[model samples]
Target chain A: GAGVSQSPSNKVTEKGKDVELRCDPISGHTALYWYRQSLGQGLEFLIYFQGNSAPDKSGLPSDRFSAERTGGSVSTLTIQRTQQEDSAVYLCASSLARWDTEAFFGQGTRLTVV
Target chain B: AQRVTQPEKLLSVFKGAPVELKCNYSYSGSPELFWYVQYSRQRLQLLLRHISRESIKGFTADLNKGETSFHLKKPFAQEEDSAMYYCALSKAAGNKLTFGGGTRVLVKP
Candidate 1:
């Protein structure tokens, strides 16, 4: 892909419903990151995947938030029992690799929990 | 724990005026600093990185290790420069980044 691509650019889900967000990072890029952007807020780190290394999930806000990267290419973020507070933009980014490299960001998924 | 701070939430400048957006970071090890911008209706994109030390769209940032600041600067502000700017930092050899609160710049013509 020319850049990072996220699916369901906009999503509206009812409270308690589960939602899945997808990200396809730039081909051959080895590092992927997930972030959450709330209204008028800074980007909040969610998770990161580097090649086949164990993912860094320290930033996940709660047990309901989980993510996984398959084959080191595509990734999915699953939110279970979503809450109104979960409404925000979910962004994905990828870089050639970690360490001193530039990252390309996707359009982002705006998830609205109604 | 790495952290980035952008004190000003909004900055307004007249066209042709010099502009500076402040950013500070706190990290124990050597850090990689970057500025990302989000234009109206556009996706967030990287404006510049400290390691590259290259200016983009007339914007440049200097990373000062002593002050732990990476401030973005431009000699002349343009209306097109109006956008939300975020400063971020990552520890050397790490992938995760901590981002600042972001500053919205408005250039009046």
Candidate 2:
């Protein structure tokens, strides 16, 4: 694809419901990242995947938050039993490589936990 | 643990006025820094990176290792420069990028 793509630009789910956000990174990109953008919290790193290495999950806020990148090209962020505080924009970015390269961001998935 | 700090939450300046967005980071190892901008209704994009030592859209940022800061600056701001700016840091070996609490710049006409 020309740029990073995310599915369901806006998602509205009831509290306690599980929601899944998807990201399709640029072709041939080896690095992918997920971030959460909230009102005052700014961009919070959620997870990062580089090639075939073990993903760095240090940023996942809780057990309910999980992500998986399949085939190193597409990724999914799953929020289980979502809470009101989970309402925020989920962003995905991809870069040619992890070092000294630019990361191209997606339009972002706006999740609204009602 | 690595961290990035953006002191200002909001900065308002008149068009053609000089503008600077302060950024500071705390990292134990060598750091790579970058500036990203997001205009209204647009996706976030890279404005510049310290390694490149280049300017984009009339904006430049200098990495001061002594102060652990990478501040974005522009001599004359333009209305189009109004956007949300973020400062990010990553390890030299390319770890996950850590971002600061973005600063919103509103360039008045």
Q: How far is candidate 1 from the true structure (C-alpha RMSD, Å)?
A: 1.1
Task: Quote each prediction's TM-score.
Answer: 0.96, 0.97
Q: Measured with DockQ on alpha carbons, how good is candidate 2?
A: 0.74
Position B89, candidate 2: lDDT: 90
Q: Native contacts retained by model 1, as a fraction?
A: 0.77
Q: Write the per-residue lDDT of candidate 2 for residues B1-109, one digit (tens) a residue.
A: 8999999999999999999999999998888899999999999999999999998999999999899999999999999999999999988675678899999999999
TM-score of chain A of 2: 0.97
Q: How close is candidate 2 to the true structure, as a TM-score?
A: 0.97
**lDDT of residue A112 for candidate 1:** 97
Over the full model, what C-alpha lDDT does candidate 2 score relative to the true structure?
0.93
State which candidate has the highest lDDT: 2
lDDT tens digits by residue: candidate 1, A33-102: 9999999887888999989889999999999999999998999999999999999999999987767777
